[model samples]
Target: MEDILRQAVGVLRSMWRFRWWGLALTWVVGAAAAVVIYTMPDRYESTARVYVDTQSVLRPLMSGLAVQPNLDQQIAILSRTLITRPNVEKLINMADLNLEVTSGPQREQLVGELMSGLRIGGTGRDNLFTLAYRDGDPKRAQRVVQALMSLFVESGLVSKRQDTDTARRFIEEQIRNYEEKLTAAENRLKDFRLRNMALLDAGGRDYVGQLAAVSAQLEQARLELREAINSRDATQRQLQGEDPVLLPQMPNAAGVSIPEIDGRIDAMRKTLDALLQRYTESHPDVIGTRRVIEDLEAQKLKEIEMRREAGPGQFGSLNANPVYQQLKLVLSETEARIASLQARVGSHEARLAELRASAELLPKIDAELAQLNRDYDVHKRNYETLVQRRESANISVEMGATSGIAEFRVIDPPSLPLKPAAPNRALLMLAASVAAIGAGAALTFLISQLRPSFADGRSLREVTGLPVLGTVSLLGDPRREASERRGRYAFAGGVAGYAGAVAVVTAALKMLQG
Candidate 1:
């Protein structure tokens, strides 16, 4: 450790023997660094902060249970939109940024530089954002910020107005279509009713009762007519030349009593009983029995003739022939009348069925058409209302700027900075100092490596590794030594250069302080 320390001290001492050169270089470098820093132009910076909070207009559409839009995403979108070419150009035009001297690649370079200076960033957890720009003038930065904010508001409102107009137009078109359909349906129903005229008034129990009564009267008339015709035919038959029936007497000892063969046999039996009681079988009374039987048989042939003469009242009760004949004639007429009435009833029933079927369907169709018409009207009204609002929106008065609470608010406007943010003077000077120290150390190392000759005995011995056999001393007088120091060119020049470097450093320090 001691040896290492001794070696380090010796090296430092050897290096410091050329300390004058290091001092001169330090002065020269420091002066140059100060001069460059002083000549550089001053730059100005402006910073603005904005808070982007949530607003209803920018909020996402949602149902009761739906998730809301992410505020961070919305802010990101707004930021990107603001940085677009149109927005940037608008701000440039509105603010009248002084870029007249800038042209071609230089102008483009300036714009790029400006873009780099303009910072847009937001905090992750907070809604606050920072916007900053650096320029030669501070007021231009403030104007740019104001213009951008105004343009953003205008663009958003315009988008909303367009959407509203589209919605109104779509609704109106749909309403018109529905109205046409409703009108057609109503017209069809009216036409159907007009064509089937009778169906409208034909209904209720009166029509049914009348139809039944007519049928009953007709039936009774048909029954009476039939009986009258039967009576008239029977009378005609009796008047014709037909053989008279003979009565069958009770069987005597000589003749068989065939009552079925003789229709008048009962009449003959009564006569025979009267005769047999007055005389014996051989008596003249028996001959009178045969005559009486024959007379009864002849009378039986005219019974239908007698029935015809009885007229409308001769028969007993309901069975009287004259009354029955009259009743039968009335009955036949009633039956014919009933046949006509029955046909009418059938016709009425068919018409009623047709009318009923038509009536049943008409109401259902009418009801459906009515509902359609109502819906069409409601939609039409809504469409008209929207159209009016949209038309109003197109006017300047309606599109006028509105001042309200906003999601994004500017906290600080941009302003120009007095000093250039680039090319830091302090850093440049520090670098220059470091470079001077390095050069000084490098020169010393080079001289050491070159093994330069020194007047000192130990160094001369160390370099050549040869013995110094003798030493020469006091060869010159005092006056000559003094003259040598004054006239020596190498020593005089090196000292002058060192003094000039020191004077330059002192002047630079004074200028920097001023």
Candidate 2:
């Protein structure tokens, strides 16, 4: 510790020995540094505070019905994009910045400078954001901050409105496309039904039920025909042993009565006879009635021959016996029913064949129909979702126009700053003082090293590695001492002049700042 102290004392003494030079250099360097610092441009800062109000009076009413933008995210984005090239250019024009460059690169550099000077920050865990700008001019700094605030608010509204419009247009386009698809699907379903109309069971009766009904009717017809043939043969056998004139009358079958047919034939003959009485045989009504009577007579004769063949009996005037005629009528009716049932059976068979063929196509048709239905359902769901979203978008647009939700409000407007924020004068002066002192000390040390003089016996012993003898004192010369005194005065005068010059520069700087 003592050694360190002694070394420090030695350095101080050496500095003091060259005190005039040290003082002159210290004042000159300090004054020069102070002037340079004062000449630097002062930067004024202006700031504005913006509050994001995400609460609205209509929010409760439109909670689920309107699109709500993320306020924090939007604010974050605005903070980043607020100082873009276009916005910066607008700020420069509005504030009339003192940039005189006309070239694109120079303009870009100016914009970059503006951006670098701009600062945007958000308060912790709050909806408040701050916009700050620094510039040489206080008013220009305020104007820049004001412009940024306006851009932040306006850009948010514009972006929201544009998004709503785009959403509505996209939904409308999707709805139109789905509508066409739905129409086509409906038409295909209709055509499919129409094309397979015969194969489809309108009454919901399955194929098995239809086939059973037709077979049952066919079997009943066959039973009735068999009964009628047996009755006809019995009647024919009974007629062979009896006289034709004395044959007994018989009751008509349930569904067939010879008497009724005979009455119809008689009525037609009488009508024809009456027509012949009124007009010539070649008259239209007369010819038509005669043709009808002839057709009935021919039908009766055919029936008689059918009965005779059915029994294998000799029939003499079989039509004259009412029993045989009745049996023959029943036989003819049964045969007609059998023929009708056979035709119906054939039709049923064709229908069954058609059903089988349609059944073969059912799986493929069902698969296709299912796919169409699935597509229709998907499109329908999507269309509905789009419609819902479109409604929300419309509501959001209306809410944006009427409400303050997701909006920025400038709580504190930018003000003209009175003091410079940058080029801290006091700190710069202090640093200059430190640097000047360091420089003076360095020059003193350098001069001492160049002179190569020993300060004490210890330094001499260190240099020569020899023991020191008693020190010698030299007598002073008056003339030399007088010259040294004059040199001291000159050194003092030079230091005073340098100090006065520094004071003058400082006073001028203060006047310029004022």
Candidate 3:
């Protein structure tokens, strides 16, 4: 520590050797620096802090809850906009700043200086932003900050209003279109019901009763036809035996009883042909008529055979045969009656079946119409509900609006600075003093280096190779150096000239600054 102190003393002593020149220069340079600092225009800075609303910063939450704007995106947008040319120019105009550049280089330099003074920063870990601007006038800086705030707020409101209006109009159009589609669907269902009356199930009233009645009539007609056909077939079998009964009595008159048996057979064959012409083979009456015709044929053959066996004598008696005559008469009359009854019954059955089919079709049509009506009613009700809601929406649109997307609020106010933030007079003066002292030291060092004499007295002896002589002191006060002292006067004059020149230059700089 002592050695360090001793080194510090040695440096100070060397520095003090030029004290006279150093002190004079220090005052002159310091005064010049002061003048320059005071003459320069004072720069004023204004700053404002704003807290960005988290609502604008958060992302839109479309589903679960209400959405908030993304804060990070808003901050980024603000950052870029803060440096935009339009914003800067507007600030300049609004603040009434008078700035000029005499040349291209000057303009460029001024731009750099302006950019350096303008600052935008954010509060740590918060959604707060700070904006600052510096100008020659304090009021201009304050006004510039205020102008930016107003512009941002107005711009945001304008953008939000436009977007909300667009969305509202689009939703209205969609609602109207849905309403039209719903109405058309309802109308279609209504028309379909009107066309299919059976859809209502109204005409199916006697469906079961009518079906049963038609079935009963069919059964009864079938039973009657079967009985007639069976009776006819039984009679035919009995009459078709090998021989027919003969009539002997009225015989005296009919010993001629077989008299016209062949003629009678011819009459019966003609009656059978007439019956066949009136009815189909499968008809109940036709089956009975056919069976009767077969019986007549068989009985006529037997009589003819009997007549041939009894010879021509009993020919007339054949018709008088009791069984043969009785058979022929009954067969012809019954066949004729059966044919008429069958024709009448068949006609009634065909007409009844047609009526029954018509009844069945009516019920089906009614059922279909009923279903269509039900569907139409449902659609119409839904359409009416939607239409009412749409009307309400329209009225609401005209009355008031509920769009609330964007809003702004002030966060922090501008502050007035307590101290001047420009020029830095004290620091400038100190710097000038240091430079002046350094210049004095440098001038002394340069003079010492240029001199012809050696700094070490022993070096001169060694170069000349001579015996040492009495030592002479090169440094001393002029009055104290008795031997000639001629070099001392010259050295003093040179130092004086240098100091005088420094004083003149320092004074000129001061005058210029003032």
Tens-digit per-residue lDDT, 340-447, candidate 1: 334434544555555455655545544554565566566566657655544553332232224221345667655445545645555555666667657766677566
Please report how far candidate 2 places residue 476 from its true position, in Å: 24
lDDT of 2: 0.70
TM-score computed on alpha carbons, candidate 3: 0.38
RMSD of candidates 1 onward, in order: 25.4, 13.2, 21.6
User: On a 0 to 100 scale, what is the lDDT of residue 69 in model 2?
Assistant: 71
User: Which pairs, if any, clash in model 2?
Assistant: none
Which scores better on TM-score, 1 or 2? 2
TM-scores, all models, native as reference: 0.38, 0.54, 0.38
TM-score of 2: 0.54
Relative to the true structure, how large is the alpha-carbon lDDT of every model?
0.52, 0.70, 0.56
Instruction: List model 2 lDDT by residue over 189-299, tens digit each.
Output: 678768856554555344555456646655665566566566646655665664434233233322232453566565556656765787786555565556555766788
Error of 3 at 330 (Å): 46
Give the lDDT of residue 262 in candidate 2: 66
Per-residue lDDT tens digits for candidate 3, residues 349-451, read 8746665657757566556545655665665666665555555444433332343333455677665554456655545555665676577666544444444
lDDT of 2 at 461: 82
Model 3 lDDT at residue 145: 68
By lDDT: ranked, best first: 2, 3, 1
